[model samples]
Target: MHFLPHHLADLAALAQMALAFLALCLVGRFVGGRQAQFEIDALAGWGLLAALLTLWGVATTLSLRIPAAAFLAAALVAVIWPGRRPDRAAWGELGRLVVLVLPILAIMATILPSQSDIFMNLMPNAAYLVDHGTFPTAGAPDAHSFLPVAPYNTQLVPFLGSLVIGGFQAGGLALFTICLYLMAALLFARMLVTPIDGADARPETRPGWAATGFGILLVTLLNPGFVPRVAFAGYGEAPVAITLLFAGWLACRAMVAMTAGETGRTSLVQLALVLVALVNVKQQAIGMLIAFALAAILVAGYERQIGWRRAALAFGAAALPAMALYLVWRVFVLTRFPDGELKPLPFDEWNWGNLAPIFVSMGKVVVEKITFFACVAVLFVFLERRLRHRQLDATGKALGLAAATFLLYNGFLVVTYIGHFPGVMSVEAHSFFRYNTHLALLIEFALVVTIRNRLTPWLASCPSLARQAGVAAIVLALLVPVGFAKRLRFDFDQPQPVVRQLALQLAPELKDDDRVALLLPGDTNSVDWMLMSLLHFSAPRRPGLDVKPWDHADQAAFDEAAAEGYGLAFLSCTKGNSLGLPDHASALLRHGADGWEPVKVWPYPPVDPKQRWQPALAPGPLCRS
Candidate 1:
């Protein structure tokens, strides 16, 4: 599953992706320097600082090139600066990461974007920001549904993709998303490897850094709610999940540093940057950061290990950035898109009295997610084992942080349901499993850190075991995405990518004012309007590619279409049509004043990664009726 040197093309793409990432971190390093605490590595130093910088540019200049140019300068400085060079240990860690997870990177480097959110949210919004260069002065055009959702509106992952290859290429987005997860894993693993001062006498004897880190990545995917396809599909959860882990790590480390009498200045900067990332990544993130801070204070102030003054300092450091970012975004959103209508539910639907059922519903969801409970159960088991004696060490502290934050964050979620989302979504708690995923890694990594006391010895004896298991996981991660691409389900949704491919194939001939409509043999109401929406957003300035599904049964429908200038129509792949699309297959279409016309059928083929996901445009219309 590891990347091979012989795969030069993939290697180059991965390298470009990695260098782009390091370039962002380079800027972070230069901006932070001695003011930041990167006790392990500087991966999360700026915590979506690139995205924030890009947002400001979008607000002002409206070009990613501005931030790209800045990062390019950082890249140049990185090329010559002796201070920016990786230390020997860091170099070795880099090599280990390459060998252990190269295949996973390969998967990240190759997959195309097929997720609905890419079409509906990220890509359209990225295009809007780059094109308009400001917060939206108005709402979505009536012809298109490019309504950007709040909080998820931040374009870090998409911005990186655009920076890598023009705009929002799925491959680039995937690589960056995986890289984001990798950064979080490294932070967690580093925290795992390093013991609190004076807690472990033989910290040097610990093993499994890269392997354990890679395992942390696996734990994230192991999440029952984590559909790898969706996570990689340009949604905001994966980023939120990973960045929360990053912020959680930084927050906990700040307290640990406090206990060890490390200088507070750098710690404050580190906490602040991640806090900025956290708040911008999701609306609920401010609450999550508060949970983390409270957990940190509880653990650090245990028996007054750190005086209240220092704890208050750490609290101030975290709160200040979170408040500033939250307010900045709030003001931006309020002043610009005050009528933003893409909310999950309206406040008028709120029912505060529904808390008991919502709580029970949430409990059912939690109980159903055995994976989540196992995560918590491991913490309980480890905490029990470790605290058999009445002593709390760094491992114990992390366990408590995980437990404390888990309870607090879940409480915050209940508030959200009551205040903002109590409606039909409240029945199942609206993607409860998926939302919990944001904190899954923190708990999983905490368990990884705690279990070391039990596993490190056997692992030390069988040093190759961790490496081999991690290698297998790497193999599985690479192989798993292949299975997704092989079918048309959530991971690699049917028709969306293929429809986009068909649109691109037909784009050059499409007139700027023309709207495309799908001529389905029959309507099952499938595609969820996704196929047409994707095609509509496929072009720049939207170019009015307006896509609508054509009803073949009614001549009045055809007349209405002609009234609306529907000149281009394609025979859509439908069940009655046997889902087989022949390349150049002729179909009947009412081409405006031209009356009935025979046109080449639009091809919608199944995605097969084995064939590099080529759309199999065949030779005949397999339409049954």
Candidate 2:
């Protein structure tokens, strides 16, 4: 009877959401009295409020019996109280946006495979940590520590995974991935609503406001650059993007408060933490921090908040903790390379001239990524006129800050990487192009919104120019999505046949407590899918399934394989055969003619002749010395 009611309740809740959104929009239009701006705001605000309330209601009903009921109840009370006032439209609007955006974002993340090998390595590490209450050594044969400060690299993510794996039970790779996905979306949402002094142009215009807010959100969400690297063969840009969005939001807010002669300690502290996290996660964001600092100086100068003594103290207070954490992490964890050795580059190589490629790469990354090359040309003329008239608002100013920071930081990277960039260009070595792509998307959104607002005034004065600019902005904005549509689709739907085939082939053979060695893609280090399936099949205590290195080979590698006790093996032919797995592996070898014999081969789909599969020519009975 309890189960029956629960299922019925679930269906009823979903039906309510569908009906509620429709009602909210109609109610918004009726109350707004045909004012586009008011209707837009009402639609977004009321829509959000309704959605949040609905979810809260359902969650309360579903989760009331749980121990954390008190906490949930308190949270709902606070959320409801804020919207009780007449001027709580923003709260409602945000709530509506949250409901509409968050679910879609979560779906996108859930559907995507965990494109991070780091997640796989972290889950197992978390398990070991739970049992031993200590960080494991990277040198330990069985331990899969991707970073030296194992606990830190494996931060909040693993605990989230522990929920599914049952208190650090063997594998929670999917759980960790889901946490990261949600965290990124949540951070993005928080950043969007966070007020920036310069970004709220024509705050009265609801469509404009909606466009700006949704634009920024889309910049973070829809940009192909946010997609995880393993799927795109990229890095953890999602984490970095989330970090930057949070940092940028805090920085913009601080600038706003400073402009109004108000100092926000919380914003200052947040900015500092974000900077620290940026450097900790991806060191290149250091350039972004430096550029933003310069922009802050510009903003302060423009607003006349240039009290050197006060500014210095405020910055020092915010920055000290991040710096301390960075110093500690660098000294303890980040210093050790995968080989367990620390290698530092020479001082001469770190200079501005050598760093030019980094900046260029960064610039190229932002521009090329959001298809800024196309949009800039379309929106530039109108923005130029708006700047001439001095109609640009706080949003414009913040955007300018972001754009300048991107160019400067990206330029710094370009100079640093370019001297050697020519040599490494072909190999795509340390390019830093992907991060730049995200920066570009951020810049483009700001530029488009600024241009969109500026053009309306010009429609009266220089109607001809206004018409051209309007047409261009709309066309470019439309095209921007098209440019990125391929990448997004790829992320959403591209077939990972190599990985799928490997997992499917190994699925039937898998049983409770059976360890399996699934091959990684050659030229890449992704492993979550294979590892997740293993967890799915064997829980609590699965046998040792070793994922052998496909990079450098040594005796220790062989020793690790022998320790795992894997009796069966499957390899991804695409993940090259020559790296770590030896020709005389106990279970299987690379093109060997020994005691081994072929069992089964499941090639990737499309079975095209060109779609090659390496035949596992094992040693048959006739083979002898």
- Which one is best on lDDT? 1
Candidate 1, residues 1-625, lDDT tens digits: the string is 2212345544443554576666666556654452222222344434545345635743664555566556567656854677765445555655555555554554556555455555555555554544443444455443243455356334553454345545433344455566666665455445545553332112232225455445445544554335676565556677767766665555565666566666545445666766666676656777787887787777666725677777766766666766776777676667667666344356666677788888788888878887777778777777676568745666777777778888888888887777676456664576677778777777876776666666777877996886786577556644554454433133343334444555565555566677666665444443424455445554443435667765453456556667777776655443333324344332434484556454555434433444333222111122322
**Local distance difference test, each candidate:** 0.57, 0.41
Query: 109 in model 2: Cα distance from truth in Å?
Result: 5.5
For model 2, residues 2-47, the per-residue Cα lDDT tens digits are 1112333233322322333223333333223222222232223232
Highest-TM-score candidate = 1
Backbone clashes for every candidate come to: 4, 35
TM-score for candidate 2, please give it: 0.58
* Every model's TM-score: 0.78, 0.58
As a TM-score, model 1 comes out at 0.78
